[model samples]
Target chain A: MSVIAFAKNWNGKFKNSTFELVSYTKALANQLNTNMVVLSIGEVAEEELKLLGNYGADKVLTVSNPQLNTLTSRAYADIVAKAANSVEAEVIVLSDNNSGKAIAPRVSVKLKAGHVAAVQELPLSLDPFVVKKSVFSGKAFGHIQIKSDKKILTIAKNCFGLVANPCDVAIEEFALDIDTNLFKVKIIQEEEQKDKVILSDADIVVSAGRGMRSPENWTPVEELAEVLGAATACSRPVSDEGWRGHEEHVGQTGKVIAPNLYIAAGISGAIQHVAGISRSKCIVAINTDPEAPIFSVADYGIVGDVMDVLPRLTKALRNSKS
Target chain B: MKILVCISNVPDTTTKVKFKEGDSLFDDSGVQWIINPWDELALTRAMELKEDAGNSVNEICVIHVGGASADATLRKALAIGADKAVRIDACPADAYHVAGQIAEYLKENPFDIILSGIESSDYNGSSVGAMIAEFMDYPGISSVTSVNLDDDDIQINRAIPGGKQVLKTEAPFVAVVQKGIATEPRIPSMRGIMMARKKPLEVKPAVELEVLTESIKFELPQEKGACKMIDSESAEQLVELLKNEAKVL
Candidate 1:
C-alpha cells in the first residue's frame, strides 16, 4: 500500500505547509518502503504541481474542480477519503493547522484509520508504529501507538523541516466522486491578505504581547516585521482586548507557530504561549522586566522598554537591508 | 432548538503534569479537577444561544464520556446553566474512542445542534468534535469563533491562519468552537448551585469501542538553559548578537 499526503491549495497555488508534509511523509514512506503519493486539491497549475517531485513526492494527483475551490469540511473530507481508498493508502499525512485539524478527523473516521494529531517526530518503531506527540498543552510528550493497520498523522507546523529530495513525479488527474448535496454550506466571504507573508508559511515571526500596551503601538511591530520580512503575531490577551484580531493570537487555544526565528516584543511567556512556540528554532525576547518568563525560553533576551528597542531594531534592519 | 454540549473533566490549567508507572499513567493524586477551559467556552456559547432563541430553544443538555469521577464537572455544568446532564460511564482512552462513545450516545438521542470545544486541554488532540460529526454523518465546522442562529440556518465564522471566513449551514450541524466563541465562562452562583442538586444528571453505560490507539509512554520537555541577558540600553549590541552569535538574523 502507498502513503498519501493531502496538499491544500489556496489562491490557485499550493500552501507552503504542503511542502513540509511532503518532505516528512517522503521520509516516512521510505521507512515503510512504500510509494509516496501527494493529493493536491483545488486549482493548481501543472508546472507548480511538477515541483512536488522536487520535494519528494513520487506521484502527484491533482483534483481540479471549480466547485471544490473553497473549503467545505464534508466535501473535502469525502474527496480525501475517496483518494486514500483509491490509492489503498496505509498512512495519510497532514499538517496540524486549522484546515488539517478540521479535516483529519473526518478523513480518519471515513477511512477507519487511527488518527494522531500534532505529532512532532516520525515513527519510532514500525512494528508497533509508535509516534511522539505533544500533550498537556505542550507541557509533556506522549508516545502513542496506533494499533490499526491504517493510520492518519498530522504534523505540527514547523516541527519537520522541508528538505529537497528529487523524485520522479507523474502527475495524474483525479475526478472526485462527490455527492451533489455537499455544497449546502457556501463560503459567503473570503478576505485574503495579498502581498504579505502568510503567518504559518513564514520562517521568521515577530510577535507582541500585552506589554505593547495598545493597538496603536503595533505600528512599530509591523514595521519591524516589514523590515525583517517576517509575519506578525500577538499573545492571547492582546487579541482578547481587541488590540489585535483573533487570527493573530498564538497560544494553546490559538494558532501554534514554530519558525526559524521567533522574536517577542514586550511579551511575557505564559506556559500556554510558550507551548505554541516551543518548536521554534531560535527565540529572542524583548521586555523591560528582567524577570519576565519569556527570558527563560529565549536564546537571547533584552531587558528594555519595547518602545525604545523596537525603533532601533527596525532602523538597524532597514540599514542592513539597504 | 435542541443543543447538546460536550464537556471534559481535566486538570486545572495551572496544575503541573506528572506521570507514573513508566510514564504510562497520568498521576492525579493532588491535582485539582475542573471543567476543560475550551469546553467551558463552548458551553457558555451554547447557553447564550439558548437565551437568544428564547421560546424556540427548549433545552441545553451537557454530556461527558467519563465515570463517576466526572459527575462533579457535570454538576458544575448544570449550575452554569445546563438544563440536564448525561454521564456516559466510561473513562476516555483516546480521542477516537471518546468520539465513538459520544457518537453512540448522540445516535440514540438526536439534537438540532451539537457543540463542543476544539479539543480537551489535556490531550490537545482537537479531533473529537470533527470525529463525532463524521460518525453521525453531519456537517462539522472547526475553529468557529461565532455562531448566530438564523431561524433554521446557522451562520458561523471560523479562523484561518491569517484571517477568518464565514459559512452558512442549516440545522443538525456540529461546531467546534474556540476562545472567541464566548467572552468568559459563567461561574456557578449560590442559588444556581442549590438548584443544580435537583437537576437531572443521568448516568448511562458507555458503548464498546474498537479502540485504535494506545499511549506507550510520556516524557517532559527539556528544561531551557540560562538566558543570555543583555543590557537594556545596548540595543545595537543585541542586534549584533542576533546576527553574529545567534545567527538567526
Candidate 2:
C-alpha cells in the first residue's frame, strides 16, 4: 500500500501548503512503512516539482494538464482516487487548505473511505490510521480512525514541523484519464486574503478583542504581531466591529487555528472563540480583566492593559536577543 | 434564481456543553438552539441574491436535517426572510446520513445554486456540503466571499490563504460559504419576524439514518486548575514565577 500526497503547480510557484503537506505525508508514510508518492496536478513546472524531494517526498506523480490548474474538486478526486487505486494506496494525505478542504470529503465518498479534515497530529496507530483532530472548533480533541482501506485526511497546516530531509526523489509524470463528468463545478476564480500569513498556518498569532475597546487601538496589536513576526488576528467582536478584517478573525465561528504560539491581547476567551484557537501550543493572554474567560486557557496570563503590556513584551523579547 | 439553502440547528455559541445521562446524548435541558453559525452564510446570501436580481430570486428555500426544536432555527431563517422552508425531519447523526437526505431532496428539485455553511458548529465534521455536491454530481466551490452571477457562469470570489480568487463556474453549482459572504447575517428585523410567521413552514418525516458512530458515554471536561495569581507589584517576581512555576520562559 502506498501513501499519496497532493502537491500543486500553483500560479507558477510551489504553494507553501503543498510543500508542508508533503513533509507531513513523508512522516506518516515513514511511520506506516510504505513508499510515498506526491501528486502534483496541472501544468506544474519541473523546477517547482523538484522541491518535493527536499520536503521528503520519494516519487512525485506529476499530473500536469490544462484540464487541471483550476480548483476542480471532482476532477482532482477522480484522479487521486484512480491513482490511489492503481498504486493500492491505503492512505491519501492532503493539506487542510482551501483545495484540500474542498476535495478530501468528495474523494472519500468516491473511495468510500473514512475521511477526517483539519487533522492536527500524526497517526498514533498505523494499522487503523487513527489520528487526532480538533472538534467543536478547537474546544476539544477527537481521535478518529479511517476504517476503510482508502483513508482521506486533511492535515492542519503547520501541525508538524518542516524537516529538511535531503533526498533526490524521482519525479515521474503519471496521468489519470478521469472523465470530465466527475466535476460538477468548474472554478472561474479563486480569492485570497491580502498580504498576510494565513492565520491557520501561522507559527505565532497575536490577537486582540474588544477590550482594546476601539478600532483605533488595533495599531498596538498589529505592532506586537509585527515585532514577533506573527500573524495578527482578532476576536469575533473585533471583526464584527471592523477593527480587523473578517479573515483576521480567529475563533469558533471564525477560523479554527492551531498556531504554535497564540498571543491574545484585550480579548476574553469566550468558549465559542476559545473553541477555535484553544489548540495553540502556547497561549499568552494579556487583559486587564482578571475575570475574563481568556485567562482560563492562557499558559501565561498577564493582568494589565494590552496596550501597556504589548509594548513591554515586544521590547523585552527584542532586548533579550540583543 | 431559485435558491435552496441548508442550515443546521445547533446549540447557541456560548452553551456550556454537557453530556446527558450516559454521555451518548447531549443534555437538552435548558439548551437554547440557534441557526448553525456556518449555515448563516447560505441563508443570508440566498436572501441577498434574491434582492439583487430585482426580486428574481423567487424563493429562498431553507432546509435542515433535524427535529422539532429545529423549528426555532427554521423560523430564524424565515425571520431573516426566506420565502419558504422544509425540514427533512431526521436527526442525521452521521455525515453520510445527512448527505443522503439532502441529496435525495436535491434530486427532486434542481436548484440554480445551492449554498450551505462550510461546516456545522456542533459536529465540526465539514463533510455534509461536499458530500451533497458529490452525491448529486454538482459542481461547487467553498468559502466563497463574493458571488456575481453573469450570463451563463457564476463569478465567485472564493477565499484562500493569502487573498481571494475571482473564479467563475457555470450554473447549477454548489457553494459552501464562510462568514465573509454576506453583510454579517442581519439580526432578524421586526417586520421580517412578523412575515416569517405567515411564511410556509413544511415539516416532512425524517429520512432513515444509518448511525456509524457509537457514543459510548458523555463526560464533562476536566475542570480548570485553580487560578494562580502572583503579586502584581514587580516584573522580576512575575518573571521568576513564570520560569520556575509555569515552566515557560
Candidate 3:
C-alpha cells in the first residue's frame, strides 16, 4: 500500500502549498508504514519535478499529455484513479484549494473511496481512521471517521507546514489512454491577474472595513500593505459598498484566508467575518470601539479613529522598514 | 429549459454556534434557519435568468435533501421565485449520502441545468455538487461567479488562482456557484410569500445509500487571551510590540 499526493504547479513551478502537501503525505506514509508517491499532471520540467524529493517523496509520476494541459475535472480524476490503482494506493491526498475541491470528490466517486475535505490534522486513530476538521465556518470542529477502506482527503492550506526530508527520488513517466469525450467543456478565454500579492498565498494581510469611511480613503490601507509586502483585503460591507473588488472580500461567503498575520482596521468583527480569518496565527485589530467583537479574538487592540490611526500606523511601519 | 437549484438549511450567519449531547450534536434551541448563503445567490441568479425573455429558462426548481424541518427553507426558496421545490425526506447524513439521494432522484426527473452552492455554511464540505455531477456523468463547473444564457448557449465565468476564466458548456451540466453570481439575494415580496403557499413542495422518500463518514465529536475553538491594549497616542509602540513581543513583523 502507498500514499498518493497530488502536486499542483503553475507555469512549471511548484508553490509553497505543494511542498506542504508533500510533507503531509510523507508524514502520513510514515504512520501507515508505506511509501509516498507524488503525482504531477501536465507539463513540468524534470528539474522542477525533482524538488518533491526534498520533501520525502519516494517516487514522482509525471503525466505530460498535451490534452491534459487544461484542467478537466473528469479527466483529471480518471488519471488520479489510474495512478492509485497502479501503485495500490490506500489514501489519496490533495490541497483544499479550488482545483482540489473540484476534483477530489469526483476522484472519490470514481474510486468508491470515503472522502473528507479541509481536513485539519493527521489521523487521531489509525484503527478507525478518524480525522478532525472545522465546521460551521470555523465556529466548531468535527472529528470525522472514514469508514471505507479507500480514503481521500483534502488538507486545509497552511495547517501543515513544510518539513524537509530529502531522499533519492525515482521519477517515472505515466502514460494512460485518453478519452476525448471527457473534454466536454471548452475554454473561451483566460485572464490572469498580474503584479499583486495573491491574498490566499500571502504571509501577511492588511484588511479594512466600513471604518475606512469611504472608497477614496483607502490610500492608507494600501500604503500599509505595500510597506509590509502584504496583500490587501476588505470586509464584506466594503466590497458590497463597491469600495473594493469582490475578490478582496475576506469573510464566510468570500475567500477564507489563513495568513501568518492579519491586521484589521475600522472593521467591527462579525462572526461571519471572523470565521474566515480565525485560522490566522496572529490578529491585530484597530477600531474606535474598544468593545468590538474583533477585539475578543485579536492578539492586540488599539482604540482610535481609523482615519487617524491608519496614516500614523502606515508611517510608523514605513519608517521602521527604511 | 428547466433549471434546478440545490439549497441547504443552515443556522443564520449571526447565530453563535453551540453543541450539546456531550459535544456530539448541535444545539438548536434559539437558532434561526435560513437558506445557505451561496445557494441563495445561486437561486437568485436562476430567477434573473428566468426573468429574461431572451432565455429559454421557463421553470426554476429548488431541491433539498433534509428532514421536514427544512420545508420552511424550501418555501422560502419558492418565495424567492422558485416555481417548484423538492425535499428528499431524510436526515442529511453526509455529503456522499446527500449527493447520492439527489442523484437517484434526478435519474427519473432530469433538468437541463443544475446549480448548487460551493459548500453549505453548516458543514462547509464543498463536495455535493461535483459528486452529484459525477454520479450522473454530467459536466460540473465549480467556483462559478457568473452564469448567462446567450441565444440558447450557456456562458460561465469562474474564479481561478490569480485571475478568472470564461468557459462555454452545453446543457445537462452542474455549476457549483459562489458569490458574484448575483449582486444581492432577492427578498421575498408580500405577494410572492402568499404565492409560495400554493407552490408545489413535493416530499419524496430518500434512496438508501451507505453512509461513509460519521462525526464522533464536536469542539469549539479555544478562547483567545485578552487583547493587549496600546495607547492611541503611541502608535509607534504597537509596531515595536509586533516586532519584539509578537514577533510577527
Highest-scoring model, lDDT: 3
The clash count for each model shown is: 0, 24, 0
List each candidate's DockQ score: 0.74, 0.38, 0.82
Q: Per TM-score, what order, best first?
A: 3, 1, 2
Residue-pair clashes, model 3: 0
For DockQ, the strongest prediction is 3
lDDT of candidate 1 over A1-322, digit per residue (tens): 9999998877677656778889999999989998888998888888888878888987888888877777788888898888999999999998888889889999888888899999998898899999999998888999999998999999987677788998778999997577877767767886667777778778899999989888888989999999889999999889888898777888887777788899999999988898778878889999888889899999888888999888888887777767
Q: Tell me the interface RMSD of model 2, in angstroms.
A: 3.5
Model 3 misplaced regions, further than 4 Å? none
How well does chain B match by TM-score in each candidate? 0.97, 0.87, 0.98
CA lDDT of every candidate: 0.87, 0.76, 0.92
What would the per-residue lDDT of candidate 3 be over residues B201-221, giving only the tens digit for each residue? 999998889898888899999
Q: Per-prediction fnat values?
A: 0.81, 0.35, 0.81
Q: Candidate 2, after superposition: displacement of residue A77 in Å?
A: 2.1
Which lDDT tens digits does candidate 2 get at residues B25-85? 6676898888888788668777777777644567789888887878888998999988888
Model with the higher TM-score, candidate 1 or 3: 3
What TM-score against the true fold does each predicted structure earn? 0.96, 0.88, 0.98
List of clashing residue pairs for candidate 3 = none
Ranking by DockQ: 3, 1, 2
